[model samples]
Target: MQSVAEFDNVGLRYGTDAETLSDISFKLFPGSFYFLTGPSGAGKTSLLKLLYLAHRPSRGAIHMFGQDIVTMPRARLPGFRRRIGVVFQDFRLVPHLSAFDNIALPLRIAGIAERDLLGPVGEMLSWIGLTERADARPATLSGGEQQRVAIARAVIGRPELLVADEPTGNVDPDMAVRLLQLFAALNRLGTTVVVATHDIHLLQEIEGAQMVRLDKGRLSDPTGSLKYPPRPLVLRS
Candidate 1:
């Protein structure tokens, strides 16, 4: 149970604004499932941003995939990012690409032959029950359908780490369950998963999952203490 990522006294803020996150710390274990839950403005999305390398922490140390990314060269960031898959809350699909092509984009970028991608992309569409919508653009699909396509695209490359932001927000309860199952299936194959959400009911859907709750830019374990860490060090914002 080696960790995929670790944070030590990590904090993030925008400009000189109030600290959005302070002294946050945690470990994301390999092949484990985690639910990052909190109220609005509790920094759930900010945490996801740090996990996926979208933003650097304003202070403290962070490591991912055994590399210290906070200090890693900018030129090498893309290589590290490719090992991780992110399912954004907005379902950031290419507006003009068909569902099949959107799912195929990762493989295409990885230099897989177009012919070699046909089987994998087709199988992903079928798994998401979107084979019929293979030719449909994101703008033409239902919310649930779009979510499925997004999830399909994220996991299609078989990444070692998967970070999803409120992934079930656009779908019904049944579809949420199905999507969670999809993640669970991927976890079985050794993908570490981190899902950020405000939905308490969704937390109950998965037994034995880890809970990392945030309160006003602070970290807490839902099963334990709620005390915010003291901000002893000087912060940027």
Candidate 2:
């Protein structure tokens, strides 16, 4: 199977005294569903930030789409980012933009035709049960609604990889399950999914999932079913 992303002995330090992530290594395969769980301040956010190219590793290498991200040109980062979609913890929607515009941003950025944008954007909004609220601003929507809108926007382009940070944090349990099912559906269609969350009870109920637990900036394969050796610990400077 082709690998979508790999972290090789990656470590991250925010400042002189803090080690955000240490000795971290993992390979996310194409069409895989992964749940990243850990306590708060355990580097889950940092890991997601690294995965999204928000921050580079303090040491070691991160390979995405067959290239070393650390060595990639800064001018090309945005193009690389377009290949992956991110649903942030904050639901970073443009408050001034309507839900439609917000979800259409990716396509618009790519210079997609105006005629072609409505189909995918509308379908995604409907899939998330937000078709009725498509004209509303983010500030007017409920937390769960905003979360769903954020998700719609992320998967609107059907990215090769989807990285969601604390995706279900604001959603009710029933809706959380629903959202997870949405992700599962996307994975079935061949998009690699990596979700960072601390919702153990919710994730454990997901069958056939590859659960990666991070503790003290270290990673583990909970099922131990993979033939590959365990990912090594990433050390912080």
Candidate 3:
């Protein structure tokens, strides 16, 4: 099976600054789960930006869904981005839109009919335990609620690849585990999941999740297993 994404000798720099990411290389296979862990300035967010097509690398190649994204025309990025879901650490919900609308945004952007959105959107609202708060705007929701909304929004589209930056940072431990389980469930359904987090305890929540660590803008895998084919996750009963 074709890998969902591959990076070859990737490096990224901002303006005249030294590279924020250097010599990064990895492959993310379909249906696999990955955790990107590193210190605060380890370039995890920068790497994720590249993964979700938010920024093009200053050097090296990035291929997603079998296409070279670095050289792909900027005009076509929106179409490619539709195939990936991103959950930003800031929650980035539209202030003017209610939680339901925020979760429904992707489907609307995909041009799904208005009549067809109620079912999926409603289900997602329920899944996040926010069905009663569906009409509440981001400002009205608590941090954890907003985070849950963001997660629901990211996964509601069921994109082929899901990239999240510090998804569990704001929640309590229980909610964090619940969110991880949500991602695990999505992974079980064949969506490639990549989560960048500082919480080491969450690493064991999903069996067979490959770990990729970054420090001072460099990649390192002590186990040397990240570059190999993904292992199947053994879900606990």
Candidate 4:
């Protein structure tokens, strides 16, 4: 089976500054769950930016969904990004849109009929336990509520790849675990999940999840798993 994404000696720099990420290489396979861990200023966010196509690396290659995204035409990026979902640390929800609309944005962008959206959107609202807050705008929700809405928005489309940055940072331990379970559930359904987090406890939440650690912009594979091709994963309950 084809890998969902592959990074070959990837390096990223901003302007004339030193590379924010260097010699980073990894492969994320379909149905696999990965935990990206590091201390503060460890280039976690920069690497995630590269993963989500928010920025191109200064050097090295990145292939996703079987295509070289670095050289892909800019005009084509929006279409490609639709296949990937991202949950930002900032919970970038639209201020003007209510929770339900924010979660439904992707489907609407894909041209799903208005009638077809209510079921999925409603189910996602229910899943996040925000059904009562569906009409609330981002400003009206608490940080945790906003975070859940952001998560629900990201996964509602069920993209092939899901990338999250410090996804559980703002929630209590129980909510954090619940969010991880949501990601695990998505992974079980075959979405490749990569979560960049500083929380080490989350690493053990999903059995068989691979780990990739970063420090000062360099990659380290403590488990030595990144060197080989990934096998089909069977996540344990």
How accurate locally, in lDDT, is each candidate? Answer: 0.86, 0.84, 0.92, 0.89
Better of 1 and 3 by lDDT: 3
Instruction: Give the per-residue lDDT of model 4 (tens digit) for 82-195.
Output: 889999999899999999999999899989999999999999999889999999999999999999999998999998999999999899988888888889888878898889
Error of 1 at 174 (Å): 1.3
Give the clashing pairs for model 1: none
The 10-residue segment with the lowest total lDDT in model 2 = 228-237
- The most accurate candidate by lDDT is 3
The TM-score that candidate 1 achieves is: 0.92
lDDT of 1 by residue, 114-202 (tens): 99999999999998899998999999999889999999999999999999999999989888888888887787687888899888887
Look at candidate 3 and give me any clashing residue pairs: none
- Give lDDT tens digits, candidate 3, residues 28-71: 88999999999999999999999999999999999999999999
Q: What's the CA error at residue 226 for candidate 4, in Å? A: 1.7
lDDT digits (tens) for residues 68-125 of candidate 2 = 8999999989988998989999999999999999999999998999999999898988
Best by the TM-score measure: 3
Which portions of model 1 show Cα errors greater than 4 Å?
Answer: 224-237
Task: Assess every candidate by TM-score.
Answer: 0.92, 0.92, 0.97, 0.95
Q: Candidate 4, which ten residues in sequence have the lowest lDDT sum?
A: 228-237
Alpha carbon deviation, residue 72, candidate 4 (Å): 0.6
